[model samples]
Target: MEKQFVLMDVDRNVYEVDRVLNAQTTNIRSFGSEWSIRLQRLHGGLSDGVDVVWVDNGCTRLAILPTRGMGIWKANVAGVPLEWHSPVQRPVHPTFVDQSRRGGIGWLDGFNELICRCGLGWHGAPGTDVTRDADGNVVSEQFLPLHGRIANLPAHSVTVEISDDGAISIVGVVDEAGMFGGHLRLTAQLTTYVGSNTFEIRDTVQNLSAGSAEAEMLYHCNIGRPFVGEGAKLHIAAAEVAPRDSRAAEGISDWPTYTGPVQGYAEQVYFVRPLTADDGRALAVLAAPEGDRAVAVRFDTSTLPWFAQWKNTQAEADGYVTGLEPCSSFPNLRSFERQQNRVVQLDPMGSVTFEFAVTVVSAADDVSRLVQEVADLQQAERMTVHDQPNPEWSP
Candidate 1:
């Protein structure tokens, strides 16, 4: 039998768990065989009123924040840290994240997370989103902020599930609703096993309104330092590779390679159409400088069909990190992505599922195998590496 704890159920007025896991512990007899789950309320600083759920499964550690869209703030696998050094050093409460600030890019203030989900309404570049009458005259226009509002919204319902077998799951539901924005609910679950080097994030975005709705999502899996410094490489099997702009064109020749932090290096992004396996699985890996260790992402392309390699190797003080993003579409503005047929449409009360797994390779042998897997997928198709930006894929 499995034990379930409700951490927050807004409709039922159940707000806190108050250290329930501390009172009830679980144990096994192999591979370190221990798991500890803790829920803590942060006080003071920018994290005021924030709730964090920590799941330490012997070999791995996860910091999941329900207050900030149920994002996994950071994680550790087999003693190796899988996180970037963002300017925001802590898990910022939604109250501190101002999406409308900075002319629109204010989302960067709370941008540091191992897996920060973007979108529920619109996850794309900031721009003017317009709607027109049947005859094409503009009816309404608004400035859509960057990456939507899911990451800055709190989950209304959260639960922790622990099976007698020692597996762990953290479930959260974040709602994006307003008089003007309609209603969309994101039911997310993060699951892992004791002493395992892998974990999975499963999300189902639902339309909770009486009418149809639009949704977008991207998993911004950011990594830095040990897994992303000099000599690092990004492995992916893509049928097409394109630079986002002229700036990214400068590095198109060495798209998969990385260098140490440079003081004035501007950010560059490459959009890829990864080739999916027969099972609809897409793989991307970021290998360490030594090539003996790495982190891999396996996603189902039936839902997330685009991949973005975000290169921001700026100085350490300025936040040096890279992102291996698996997304439903490129990070172009919502209007632009919709024109490219990238935005997803949902019927009333309909939903879509996005599933992906993150695994860390602690051994040199496993790293080689994963890299080979990417190569095998690529060889099946002729890859088109565009020297400059692909206007069709970029804004």
Candidate 2:
């Protein structure tokens, strides 16, 4: 008698059949009740010359794009969306653009995932500047890309490892260095376990030059509709909250609440310096007002000390997205950051590591527990700062 066996795919869809017959007709390899990672190319609508590393561990599924600097393009937990996507429709190659117009906004048009990395030189625009070329010749009117080129640069060495114990990880190294510019190297790794709803990201950025280099880094984790809509709310334990600019200050009072999309609604950015918990980690959550479903992001405050909340509630046709960002400093022009002494500097051959985890909360009891955790954190003592320093009366 032929033995009967069960098979499962990344979506958790299962099938039962005779093991011998199935093995004879298909390429089936038993992982011994373990998770699997498949490396394949995304074709047709999904492709613009990119390779995807797909992972599923029963509880969650992830699509990682190596050509896009290994950024997670999409993720889900038990069929529930865990990340926001832009209206770009398809993934585009990094070099498909004219050199004159390549920047953060250009890249943003293609894919906006749970995370988009920003900066080795700049995170925001500060206009043109004077710089020296590789030959030590002074060059003027040199403008850095909106968020640097790290995200658009493809990974050089990629490795995906899976263990017998049902553990899997993908590692990749991306270089964003130039002849006369900062030599920055990003080594990123992501790990997940079988049957776990949580995954972790560990990244190390190193300055591989002989001189100290200025750096800025931000993880643009976006949460959107269904998970971030009317009645959805954000809970964070922050010591201080400051508006990114005058535009954000207009909606300062309603920073933690969600509202329906408004016509001509501009984006608002709030800087949150969270109060670290006992383990030196800061917790933030976005939950549906009426459901047990929620998403949580936890990171070490020692490395990522600042968090930025980006609220974009424009017309539905355009996009309604919220960004939960954790970074070494605020998202500002590199020059301004240097003026404020907030720029991160790496000595020659120096490196810094950051770790963060995204977990899915699906149980009502667990959701309640997280709500309480946020409340407790809010009650903890904190240093307050003035939301606005310079206020001008506008008639």
Candidate 3:
């Protein structure tokens, strides 16, 4: 392993490369919100890379490798990059195209810009356009910028801290009322290492604005293909699934009705049973194919009670793996009544938090025991229902 990746010391305001890169990466360094982290790739069998930090700033948010149209040939946190072989596709480069627009709707906290390279549809009805190079490979040109006006401009407060082991912790507040009043806040802490195949991400959000401001967020993980293909099986303990009633994109809800005995992959959101392993922890599972591996998400019950599952129906998109999101909120908030079938409310000055653990394994068969442990933790906890209700998404 080469020192291919770098880390920033917030206290000293500098970046450091811990290991050397071999067949994986080249000289790459980018800055985001005062943190300058080095990027690296893994050589040998699996496909992998290390990226850091997430902020709303254009440069900061768009600095990661998967940005624009650059594709990750094989990248995985578990050290197992899904193999792409067959009469079909082979691993490729990042594919990113810019659709200059105002106000990013589907951007999902600018997180989507990190990898998907497509802007959210919000600024103008929310849509995406992809541009491919002559070889038919996706390539990115410039950063896709998304900005909005804040009602009560809170104090701009931000913090970044990294552990000895490379776990990065961040505190950011989109302050309202002079940074003292309740505001939109985001908290994330993550650690990734090429030597250690596991990468952990934890996030939280708070609302401080006046009145009932609808909030939208997504755990947008842009996956790569062939590895994330039809061979993959999405295993979640969630009891129900929801979908946007009307969207050009592919999802479960496009099927017309989400009531009773749903089968096959449809663009939909899932409502999981109040999950708790025997130790009282929330657990969710995602399993890939046999030669491939799977990912699992587990969290405590109080902080995050909701789980959402999103997958791209289009094979042409970045990758084929489903997004296993355990969040306090979802991107389609306004449609909660009709699609999600539930509402999560944040009273004035009130906040919510979610904590979970993620582990990657060699096989998908481990999902059953993992789910059973989650079920053994306890009974169903009642969730808050918003305005309208859809039986399919009702928890």
**Top-lDDT structure, candidate number:** 1
After the best TM-score superposition of candidate 3, give how far the Cα of residue 246 lies from its true spot, in angstroms: 8.8
Off by over 4 Å in 2: 1-34, 44-46, 98-104, 129-141, 163-165, 382-395
Error of 3 at 347 (Å): 5.6
Model 3 lDDT-worst window of ten: 115-124
Candidate 1: segments with Cα more than 4 A from true spot:
17-32
Ranking by TM-score: 1, 2, 3
- TM-score, candidate 3, is 0.51
lDDT agreement with native, every candidate: 0.89, 0.72, 0.37
- Better-scoring candidate (TM-score), 1 or 3: 1
- Per-prediction backbone clash count: 0, 0, 39
Candidate that would win on TM-score: 1
What candidate 3 gets wrong by more than 4 Å, as runs, is: 1-75, 82-182, 191-196, 207-216, 222-227, 241-274, 278-280, 317-321, 329-331, 335-350, 363-395
lDDT tens per residue, model 2, 1-395: 11222222223453221122122242333334335566665556546567666777777889877777778887888778776656665566676633235443565545566677777566755455444467867664566556667667777666655555555677878888888876889988888877788999999989999999877888888878667888788889888887777888888778888898787999988888888888888999888767587888899988899888889888776677888888887776665565566678889999988888998877778877887898897788664644552221100
